[model samples]
Every structure is written in C-alpha cells, then in structure tokens.
Target: MGGQENVDYSIVICTYNPDENVLKRCLQAVRQLNVANISTEVILVDNNSKVRVQDLPYIKEYTAGIPGLKQLFVVKQGLLYARLAAIAEAKGAQIVFFDDDNEPESEYLQELHRLNKQFPNVAAWGPGNVEVDFVDGVDDNIREVALQLFQHRTATTVGFAAIKDWQPCYPYGTGLCIKTDLCREYLQQVNQGRLTLTGRNGNKLSSGEDTQMIMLCISKGYAAGISPALRLTHIITAKRANRPYMNRLLYGTRSCYETCMVQVFPERKQMLESKLISGAKFSRQTLKKFLKTKWNRSPQKTFDLIQFIAAHASDYMALDKPLPGFVNKVLTSLKIV
Candidate 1:
C-alpha cells in the first residue's frame, strides 16, 4: 500500500508566498540529492501562495531532472492543510517534510533511509544538524536570538526516546520524515476536524502541528527521535529575522503553549489548569521581567517574556476577550503598538 506503489521516498516541500530565489535554491538542493537506487518522489505543496509555484519562470529549471517523480499541489490553506494534501498524494513509504527555505544535504535521503532501517520502531526522524544561513548576512545584534528563532540544532545523536524527554531533540517540521501510513492516519483526523491546531496560516503564526503529529505517533506506540546523519540548512530571509517578525513568532509560540500542552499531553490538563488559575500572580512577576527587558532594550527577550504573561493573564483574569487584550495593554504601555 505504501512503497509497494513504486515510490520509496516522497519529499514534500510546503511553501507559502516564498521568495523566488529562495525557492529555487531549495529546489536546486533537492535536484542535487544523491538518491542512489531507491525510488523517490518530490511533492511541492503550495499553501495558498499568492504566486503559483508552477507559474514561476525558474521553477521548472530547478525541478527538472530530479530522478523518480515530481508533483505540485495547491492546498490553499495553512501549513498542516498543505502537509495533509501532500500526504494524500504521497505514494512513498516515507514522507519527508521540508520547508520552502530548507536545503537538504546531498546524502540526506541516504541517511534517512539508513535511519528508517536502523530504527523501524521510530515513526518520525528529524535532522540532527539544522544549520541556519541568513540571506542578508548575519546581524551582530540578532545573531544569538536568530539561531533560536530559526530552530537550529547542532546536537548529533541517533536515539529514540519519549517525546516529552527529548526536549528540542524531537523532529521539527524542517526535514521531518514520517511514515506514509502514519501521515495518512493523521490526515483522516484533520479531515474529521478532530485536530484543532492548524499550524501557521498566513498572518497567523501559531504552530505545533508537527509536535501534534509526533505525539499522535507516540500515542500509537511509535517513537520519535533525531538522527545525526540527517542534515539540512534553513535559509532565513532578512525580513524574517528582524525583531518585528521574531516578536510575532514568539508571541505565536507562547500563545499556543496551552494548546500544545492540552492536545499533546492531555494527562497534564490539571497541572496546566492550576498554573493558569494562578496566572495573575505569575503575570505580575513576568511583567516585572518584561519591564526590565524593555529597559534593557532587548526586544526579543521582552516579547518572549510578555507573550507568556499575556496568554496566562487573560485566562486568570477570566477575560471574555481574546488574548490580544493583554497584549494590547502591554504593547500600549511599552509604546510599541
């Protein structure tokens, strides 16, 4: 039902409003894959992009001559929806998810194939070394935060453990490889509206769809882990690495903490509820730190701290309004709105 259909690996790249040059670089890297003798396929899922990927002048130039198979699908939705679309079309045993900006190493497929064989029980595998390259060159001010912002991982290891204990070791959306059947199972839940997290949708930066999928696999007794052998480079545009963009990303991350906790770790619902109930006090303490960061002119850290305060304070204060209420207040006070 899977690889028996002739596709052994399905490389899925999901993109939305991607820069033409960046997309070309990503495709160029894909065209350079050392696929050996294994049958492979590349599926590009354009997530409701303003510009159709196929219409791009340089798209065919980069995607041309890429071994086994190539496909393009327009999901016209968020990241998860686009991924689900790719899953529906993928005929390979393993479905590797790549962002439009991700450039995989030449041996990426070979390494992933080896890991799949070595750890058959591990349902999902992540790249161990996810290096970041800024298109406009690295800025000294944002250099440190940029690495964290882009989810760069330098740790090298090959092990499958509990998803919770793995920390940042678990697979992220970039260069994430999962079984086709598992992806198909997830697609069914998403289609049935059982899954609530929609990943990032246009202006909305909320995420954790990848974690949700990994958790689902774990719940079904399949493990998730990282392999040092798998590697990829995440190309960051200058516009995306700035304070404003990072602020939105951090805010999205903090706002979705409760959702991720509730959906991925349902057993900890009581703990999360208790924490949120006392969030007013936590918010006060966090506000003090936020003020200190503001004074220190650390926008990245300030937003990171404040978003947590905003998420929990809204819950504790029993605000009928959205989390933005807290955000608006803080932003007004900081004069950043």
Candidate 2:
C-alpha cells in the first residue's frame, strides 16, 4: 500500500507490552498536537501485545478527533515488523515515529512542518531535547549518568548534511521524522532480510533499526539531522532507572553498533574491519581507563567505555572472518544472543 493523496503526516506508534499509563500519556500528547489545518493520521501498530485491542478502550478515547485513525494488530513480535506494518498502511507524505513512552509538545507537528520546509533535502531528523521524566527518583550517580546517556541533547547546531561515520549524531528512535518515500525504499531492504535489528523486542534491548534507516537514507544521497526546536519527553519507569537495567541497555546498543554499520555500509566493510587494535594493547588501555574511573567513582562511565572498547575488540578479532559472525560469537559468549 502506498501513501494516500493530500495527507501531510502519519504519526506511527508501535507498542508491544507498554504500561497503560505511559501509553495513555503518549496518546494524549498525540491527540493534543496542534495540527491546525494540516491533514494527518494516527496509526497504532500493536505488536502482539498481551492485552487485546478490544480490551484497550482508552486507546479509542485518546485517538479521538485525529483525521484518520487506524489501530492495527500486528502478530510479528519485533519493533521492525511492527513499523513495517505501519509503513504499509500509512497514508501520508511524511511519517513520524513515536515510541510508547514519548510525549510530544503541542506544537510538535507544527514545528515538524516548518522543519520540512527548512531542510527540504534532509530525509530524516528528530527532536534534540529528549528530556527524561523519571517516575521514581533515582540515585544521584545513576541519575546524572542516565540523563547524559539517555537524553538526545547533542545537536549544537541545526543543519542537515552527511554525518561522518564516527559522529554520534544520528536521530534516535524517539520522535524520528522521515519522508514516506524513503520509508518505502527502506521497506524493500527490510523485507529482503537485509536489515535485521529488531529493536527492543520484549525485554531484549538490542537496537539499531532507527540508525539503520537513517544510514540507508544517507547512503542514497540524503541528509539526517536533529533540532532542539522540536521537543519530547521520554517517560522512564522505575524498572528502567536502576543500574542493572542501565548497564543492560548500554551493552545492548553497543553490541549491535558494529553489526549495524557493516550491514548498512557494506562498501566500507574492509575499512571498518581494518580499524582494530591488538587485544593486549586494547586490554591495557581499557584497564587504565577502568582503574581511573573507578578511582573517580564513576562506575557507569567505566561500564559505558568498556562496552565501546569491547565492540572494537570484537571487530578486531573478527577481522580474519565475516564481521557478523565474530560479533555474534561475542554476543553468544556474553549470552546476549
């Protein structure tokens, strides 16, 4: 199915087993969007949640008054599949992604319309002010680290251009806006089994689908960016505010980083695979940073750095063989696969 004629934007919300309160807030934010005279649609792609659609009565209440609202029940388990379903059913020239925890400002759609006009060539962009709202208070150390790591406030400038390989400015999943035509292009690659990042399937936090899509757009001579003008609040539950969960999320994202890069930019496979250091030197460097951070009482930063080093080490070790195989071996050893 292709996009419908004269539709401006399709806001897609993909959820599996979301907290009802959080989901309600997310829907309410969408409902409260100030679209003015713009034609829009709301698509809810339920990714096989335990709660049936018939049981989700509040969903209807929150989605009311949207121009074209459709709730789809997708049996596929992963975030990738759920989003794929939305792309097929979307009837808008532009598509915006909203996680179940994202709460957009009332002017989100209006700001997005302005951004589209400003950056006409940029295929993908997202909100830079991704503030985190913790339901339960967190410890000082964890709170500090979480805000720095989880928030997406890194865009110091507002411009669209080809992002370098090492630059960590790719628009994240929250509030990700992309052209519908680019989404159709991505859909073909995903359907052919070329892109495999499932992105937070159930409790498993492995992610990269968002980055993969942006990379695809970049590969096709398009730009991606982030703007502070657009804003959204990420609601973090108590379960995700602890040290253990934080470490897991960090590890999951880091583990999939290299694989996603290789998969998306196969032409640069050799260049990436060649940029590895010896295990002994890498270990010494990692140990030095670890001890220094430990002495400084920054365990979270230490763990975060270790994950990046481990990812590089995995690439270095797998230099002789296929990249994905070596990464998967490391994941299996760590029981992440």
Candidate 3:
C-alpha cells in the first residue's frame, strides 16, 4: 500500500457547544474558498458538545447545502484530544485546524497552501485573529493592520532572538495549518493514549495545548509562519469577552505557562525564570514609553495594555512563590479583586 492517499487539504474544526449560527457562518466561509488545484475536506470533530451539534437547525441546513464535504468520525474527548483524533483520520497532505467559532476569509485556504509551498520546511502557518464583537461593529481596519504585521514576520522563532516589532504568537488554534505527516510524527511521541500531545486534563480544564505544540515544533527544527492573506474573524459573545471572563482567561493562561515549564523544560526552570524577569522588565519599559509619549490612545486600548503588563509582572513574581497567599497579595495590590 502507498500509505493513506494524499488529498489536497484537510480542515479540522473542533467545537464544544458552539452556537449554531456561528458554526453556520464558519462553514459558509469555508464553502466560499475559490481554490481549485487543491480539493478541501472539512472534519468537524464535536468535542463532546453538550448542545448536540447534529440537532442544531443551522448545522442541519448548512450540511445539506455543502454536499460531498467529508464528515469524519466524531470524538467525545476535549479540544486537544478531538484535534489529535481528527489529525489521525485526516487524509490530506496539509491539515488545517480551525476553531468552530471562526469565519475565515474566502482566500484563507489558498493563502495557506501558497505559503506552505513557498516555505517547504515550514511545519505550520497561522493567520491573524480579527476579533468579532457581537455587540459592537467589526473593525476591519484594525484587522487589516494586524494581518499585515502577521505576514511581515511570517516565519520566526520564539525566545531572545525573536523578530523585532513582531509580536511572538504561536499558531492560533482557530486558523492554523500544518503538514499532516509532521503533525502525526510529533503527536506519536507526545501522545499517551487518551492524553493528547499537549496532555490536557480533559477538554474543559486543559490549557496551553496549542502553545505546547508550537514549542515542540520549534524545538524540533520546524519553522512556523503566518500569512496575511489568510484571515479569520473570531466570534466573541458578550459573556465570554467581558472583564471577568478575561481575568479568568488570563488565569488559565498563567496555568498554561506553568504546565509548559514543567513539561518542556523542567531542567531549564532557572533559565525560564530569568526570561520571566526579563519580560517583566520589558513590560515596565514599554509602559514607561507609553506614558512618556503621552499616546492618549483609546481608553480601552490603554487599559488593556496596562492590564497585560500587570499580568506579566504578576507571573514573574509568582515564579518563585507559587502559593495562593502570595497570589492573593499580588492580586489585592493590583486591585484585581
């Protein structure tokens, strides 16, 4: 046998009780891709969705419209688990992982394939996330600028030598693509039956799985890139995008950092500690720059940046003292209470 037949591309979407309308819009966007040289197959893996996606009205209508779109096996595991399962079943040479709640531009798949061919060694590619505010209108200008920045520094590494002015971000799970073979090979080593490569505790409680994969690829000499040509809008609900939810998300992100430290570089914990301190210093410097420049930017933007710096400082301080009491003190001082 010549192994699994290599198809053009396999798009894997993982969802956990997503709204039907959002899923419909995402599928509609996929259906609009104009690429013809490469065939596309969508693998919708229900991550044990409580809402029973199959019964959703819009899902039913959308599936009826998009005939021949591959409906692969569904997995009841968490997001990372379902992701791995879909990757394992994928028959395409290129595997694209998209979050269920995102709507990619019509050229998204075409751009990803173009970049993959341009950089043969690049193991992964991602697009900038355009935040879709359900309440407020879409900000296409900000999204366009973000995409431009993302493309300018397409293939870069993390750490000290990271590209200047380019915000270092792992492939966002929503609109990321990687070679199927590369994904399978790396996954085999890290995956411990039932546990995903990133090793989440289930789907809900698990975090940093995507970051873990990105670090693994970097460590293994695989280049990661981003294509401005490929764009996606991440749908944000009022409840999920509010202040309290953001704080909770930040806490989860902190836990992810701790997990990554333990898993990827337990021996280099001291080095990681140094990096955290350095990051805090950088944040302080950036804050000073903003204040000195009298940016007088949007209030929301200013507050967000300040909050990000504070979060990084808190992470650095908690590196040595990983205690609830210490965390509480930091939170109280920061007025996060």
Ranked by lDDT, the better of candidates 1 and 3 is 1
Error of 2 at 34 (Å): 0.8
Q: Which stretches of candidate 1 lie above 4 Å from their native place?
A: 1-4, 164-166, 277-279, 300-304, 310-328, 331-337
Could you tell me every candidate's TM-score relative to the true structure? Answer: 0.89, 0.87, 0.71
Candidate 3: tens digits of C-alpha lDDT, residues 1-337: 0124657788887777777667777888777776668776777777776666776677766766452355543555556667778877887888888777777888887777777777776677787445453533324423433233222233333212122112365465557787777768656755653213343333223256665655555656776656556677776555444444344444444445554544544555565576664544554555564464356544345344434554454445435544344334444443444
Model 2 alpha-carbon drift over 4 Å, by segment:
154-157, 164-169, 279-298, 313-337
- Highest TM-score against the true fold, candidate: 1
Best by lDDT: 2
TM-score of 1: 0.89
Cα displacement (angstroms), candidate 3, residue 66, comes to 3.7
Worst 10 residues of 1 by lDDT: 314-323
lDDT per model vs. reference: 0.75, 0.77, 0.58
Task: Tell me the spans in candidate 3 whose CA falls farther than 4 Å from its real position.
Answer: 1-3, 65-68, 72-77, 129-131, 135-170, 193-207, 265-267, 273-321, 328-337
Q: List the lowest-lDDT window of 10 residues for candidate 3.
A: 158-167
Q: What TM-score does structure 3 among the candidates reach?
A: 0.71
Candidate 1 C-alpha lDDT tens digits along 149-214: 687888756767765523566777789998888888887877787667778876667566877788
Residue pairs with colliding backbones in model 1 are: none
Clashing pairs in 3: none
